[model samples]
Target: MLRGSAETEAKLRFQQASGPIMAKGVEDTAFYTYQRFIACNEVGGDPDRFGVSVDSFHAYNAHKQLEWPVAMLATSTHDTKRSEDVRARLAVLSEMPDAWTRAVQRWSEMSQTYRKPSVDRSIEYHIYQNLVGAWPIDAERLQRYLEKAMREAKVFSSWTRVDEAYESAVQDFGKGLLTDQRFTADLSAFVDSINRAGEENALAQKLLALTSPGVPDIYQGTETYDYSLTDPDNRRPVDHAAHAALLDEAAKADRKTILNRWNSGLPKLWLVVQALRTRQEFPECFDDRATYEPLPSHGERLITFVRGSKASKKRVLVIATRLRRSGVTDTVVALPEGEWRDALGQRAKVQGTVKLDGLCAGLPVALLTSS
Candidate 1:
């Protein structure tokens, strides 16, 4: 069975790489073929399966107004090169181009002291400096960060065969950065800026993708902020215990207010789960046949779309905000007259047009679903 399976996989890979004729002839033909075979053979579906490219999926969503129900949209994967947090932070750079450029220039200037070193040495120094400078330093946080860095360093050192000197330097740098309070604050600010930018970008992408025509798939642990660097970090075990503790604390206290005021990420996870549950319950409303009418907002921060069956008498309008830095209050959302529910807050009312000032209020995503 193993031999046969291997042979089948090899054949499928060959077919996939042969030419566009075999891979792109039909919508997801290549992928479906592999999935069907895996199912028949009782093999678990490949996590690395090439279901569809992001570009192709987005294009399909744009073109097919009636086919939203069948398509799935996703952003992150175990095989992805960067962590979602990193991507989100990077996305902020696009919004604050000058800030990003300035930050990079600062990093470059700081790194100039070691520029003449060999490639391996330079990379080692840079990684060490980044880890040391960026790690948060509360006792518990420091321990966690150190353990993660040490584990990753071991893996990286082994994989890259970095010289003993470089490894020692990285370790020493980390130790110094951890012990020195002065450097910690400066480094923390820089790291925080990168993280904030990344989070903003990620949130924007999520809001846009979720409200778009296709079904959005949430990767594990993406609901809250994830700041891992590469594969193992991205795939780190979900800390259910910590999450439970957080939930317990929230239940005992006014967690929502704290989260909202501090921009704490706990609410984002809730929002994602709620959105998914809502989407699942109202699958008919998001069927591929539904039209996608993008509403114009005064700023790029707002994105609105309406989805409904052409044959059905009812339609659902979804308005989401991509704003991260600014607060929106009593903002008006224009929709065809009827009643609507605030999917994020469960606030409901009847009206053709509604005001949504504090609804989005720094939240990464907000949904207004009409019945």
Candidate 2:
């Protein structure tokens, strides 16, 4: 108050304090507190609400296109509780709530022997959700994330006020899961069984992020499937050299080859590279002035839309799947009369009413452009 004035002092104080308060409250504290479904515990996400309708999604995108056309559209980031692909895998759980409930119950029973005093049901539930979301995770990585999560929850343990015993017990219980043969095997079996479905969702998500109304932000290592958690974990460095090699190999690989090897993450990289290239070559289709219209599909399973204007040289069509597999849409969209080519992976051409099965050709999503 001595330097400037009371008003200036108050303004400076608010500016200094507001940033950390909201970040700690919303991004760290509240996100962990409302961990009903751990997948939705992402930054700016709600755990209770499952998902939005196709109509709602289009409306939101339309609004974004009109208002904030150049804003960065990001799915995963440093602040995300879990990476995009992690959420994609966990999303599969929503489709199988009954089985997931039973699995979580059995896992809790199995961990009873190892779980510590402070590791209550709530803690166990959050841990199980992470286990399912980030499968094939190493003991060390999961332990690190578990510690971060426990601290963030601020329930029994936290960063500011250290609770060594509680955190150690939780970490030990998490490590015990790897040692428990039955638990690991069951987790592996279930994760492997539904992996394809998760991949389908991941592909659809990746496509939409890249081709949707706003500019896509491909986080490091997310050009492929990334199952990371928030902060220091998600901040791990990417192997750009290896990714460069995959991009080279993707050119020669056929659609089935890429789709079949989902674990290699080639399909996602392929989609990203192709989509970006299309956006680069035909900038008009994705620019601010471009028109966005939802294409009519028979069912609610498909997210279908096209972008372009009468003045633009090319029109881009984006078809992505949701809540279902690729083969569900054997024949769905009836395109506008023109010569259309799959601008993404798998070079395919068609005109008039086209089967999504043939357009995507067994792939979960498709991006087409008028020639």
Once superposed on the true structure, which residue ranges of model 1 sit more than 4 Å away at CA?
1-60, 64-69, 108-116, 119-181, 191-201, 244-258, 261-264, 288-290, 297-299, 311-314, 323-332, 350-356
Compute the lDDT for candidate 2.
Answer: 0.83
Residue-level lDDT of model 1, residues 1-371, one tens digit each, is 43688899998887788775532332222222222111111112242442344344445656765544557666666644344555455434344546645654564455444443332443433343334222443433433433344333343343345455544544544455456655456667766765654455566567666667766777777766665543455677988776666555444433256355344555555555566667676666677666665555546556566666666644656655544555456468666666767666635554566566645545545576665
Each candidate's lDDT (Cα)? 0.52, 0.83
Error of 1 at 119 (Å): 5.0
Highest TM-score model number? 2
Top candidate (lDDT)? 2
All candidates: CA RMSD (Å): 9.9, 2.8
Candidate 2 lDDT by residue in tens digits, 1-371: 44668888888999999999988887787777665787877667766677988998999988988998888999988778889998999888888888888898888888888987877778788788888878888898888888888898898888899899998888899999988999999999989977888988998999899888888998889988898887778999999999999989887777778867878989888888888888997788787888888887556788999888657568988898877732475656788779888776566676788777777776778888885
Estimate the TM-score of every prediction: 0.63, 0.93
Error of 2 at 32 (Å): 1.8
The TM-score of predicted model 2 comes to 0.93
